[model samples]
Target: MIRHHPDKNLLLEYASGSLPKGASLVVSAHIQMCAECRAQYRTMNTLGGSILESCAPQAVNDKAFHRLMGRIDQAAEPEQQVTPERSKSTEPMLADAPPVVHKLLEKNPPIKWKTIAPALKMCRLKTGQDQYEVSFHRLSCGGKVAEHDHRGYELTLVLYGSFSDSDGVYSPGDFLLREPGDVHRPTVTEDQECLCFSAVQAPVAITGVSGWLLNRLIPFRPG
Candidate 1:
């Protein structure tokens, strides 16, 4: 069962399209797997639609419309463009993979995995902006990541298997958020490997001697 979830305010931000793209992507992935959150998102969207309908509509100026149409007409002139064909490999490997996850991978071809540690491997994803860095992490069972904290904010969504930290155990579809001051070590106790999608607003900061040493070799963005 899914134990972790995004708070109401985060969901509200996602529903209103106010959350940053990197954060929104993780929330969307969670919504695809969590029925409770999906229902909440629907309710929020319905409320938003109702509020929008209740607002008075603004009249468009005729001159502005004509100018917009003129620009559109000019752009409509034929221009040769090439479109690449999407490959079948773009499909998600997991049967229950979230739509947003699939969509993301479909646009940005998957990257080759590289080992950062003994049991940890990761690859980057397209964030479209420098505001946040997004990536996929896979940790083998019995692997324990160094205890660390974030510089700004971090969102992690478990996509497969399970892992545990100071707070609790996170299974597939679980959503975990850590702020600048929060610190924890994630350990994979289950026999299966853990796969997660993570986004960080700033770089992660190592606390201990071992972490500090590893910090130099691993480039975790700093706030």
Candidate 2:
């Protein structure tokens, strides 16, 4: 069972189509995994339509509207399916992630994972947007990332295994939002490795004596 979920306000923002692209992507993935959130989003959409219908009808620019619809139709075309490639060193299957995430993965597969720490590996997924950095993090059994706090906001979805912080443990399908002033060190459970996907608005601010050094040496990057 999933213990965590994005709050109602974020869901409303997503339904209203005002959320930032990367943040919206995270919320969309959560909605797909959680039936409760999906229902909430659908209800919100229905309510929005009713509200719009109640308002006075506005004049339409037919040409502009048709152009927008054409672009949307192109974007909705079915994506070709090809089995994702995997390297022997890769920790988990891309199949483990939500379907929406597949749009970012390369068709060639064998995702390039970087070793940022002894037991930590990272794989970045390009979003073609500058406002947020999107990536996946893998921590080995009993491993933990350095204690740090958010500089902006972070939305992380657990895709495999489990991890724990000061608040509580998170398992697959758990969605966590960390805003500024929030701090935690996540440690993977001893039984298995933990894998998670995240979209962040800014680099984290690591805490501790080595924080400055680590921060300088390993400033977060989209790659």
Candidate 3:
């Protein structure tokens, strides 16, 4: 189950084709695995269409409506089958996955290196100046991350294994969001390594001894 979701406002921006390609890719993937979100997306799309029609003085073109209906029908066709045996054959199956999943897993924007701690390493995917940043963090088993607070929105999506904090346990595929001012210390599971993709709006404020050490050895600032 999805532990966190993009708010209705974000979904509306996506359905209206206003979101950037990279951000839209992530949102689309979340909607595919979440039925509630999918329903909400449909409702938003309908509402947006109604608003446009209400504001426009000219009548809608019959040919344009027919073309749009055809495209929708094509998108609704049944997905192709994939055998379990075939799925395991590929190292990366993102290409063969659904459109939304494929887009999310696409190799683009490139990740740049950033050291978090001795036991942790991060790579940031640059979006733009003063905008959001996505990062891939690799944590060694039993490693403890420095306690930190977010200045803006922070979304963490677990891609492998699990971790825990004061609030609760987060496992693979779990989506967690920490709004501005939220702080927590995350500890990786002793039995396995933890890998997460995090999206942040601002630099994290590290605290305590661990933070001091990390700050001296590596740049802990946001990308």
Candidate 4:
């Protein structure tokens, strides 16, 4: 069972198509995995449709109408590929991973893991969005990350295995959001490795002597 969920305001933004690209992607992934969230999203979408239907229709100027028609004509043309890209190697998809994860991998292509600390590897993603830096984090069982504070807002969705921090344990499909200055050290359970998808508005503001020393070496992000 999923314990955490995206806040109602976040879901509302997603329903209204106003969420930032990276956030929208994570929300889409969560909705696919969480039945409760999926039903909520559908209800929100239905409400939006009803509201739209009740609104008074407005006259479209000739130029605007022509532009809209042009877009429709373009959308009607079907010549591009419909299949999602796959890895050249036979990389099996995770059994419980949402479709959005696969779509994201297709868009980014090639998964390369970078070791930032013992038992922890990160794969940064180029999501074509300037507002957030997205990535995947994998932590082997018994692994722990140095405690750190958020430089800005961050969202994490667990895809596999369980991890624990100051607050509570997070199992698969748990949604976590941290605001600036929130600090916590994450540790994976001993039973299995943990895999998570993360989106951050800024680089982490790490604390402690060990983290600072590590910062000097890799600095986490490329300059």
The most accurate candidate by TM-score is 2
Looking at candidate 3, the ten consecutive residues that score lowest on lDDT are 78-87
Off by over 4 Å in 3: 9-26, 57-115, 127-130, 210-213, 216-223
Candidate 2 structure quality by residue, lDDT tens digits, 19-129: 777777677777766777777777887798799999998777999789757544522221212224342334454465665666566432557878877778888777766
How far in Å is the alpha carbon of 86 misplaced in model 3? 8.9
Q: Write the per-residue lDDT of candidate 4 for residues 71-132, one digit (tens) a residue.
A: 44432221122224443423342445666677677777578888978878888888776888
TM-score of 1: 0.81
Q: Which is better, 2 or 4, measured by TM-score?
A: 2
Against the true structure, candidate 4 reaches a TM-score of 0.82
Count clashing pairs, candidate 3.
Answer: 0
The candidates, ranked best first by lDDT, are 4, 2, 1, 3
Kindly report the root-mean-square deviation of model 1 from the true structure over all alpha carbons.
7.8
Clashing pairs in 2: none
> Scored by Cα lDDT, where does model 4 land?
0.76
Against the true structure, candidate 2 reaches a TM-score of 0.85
RMSD of each: 7.8, 4.3, 6.3, 5.4
- TM-score for each predicted model, relative to the true structure: 0.81, 0.85, 0.66, 0.82
**Poorest lDDT segment (10 consecutive residues) of candidate 4:** 74-83
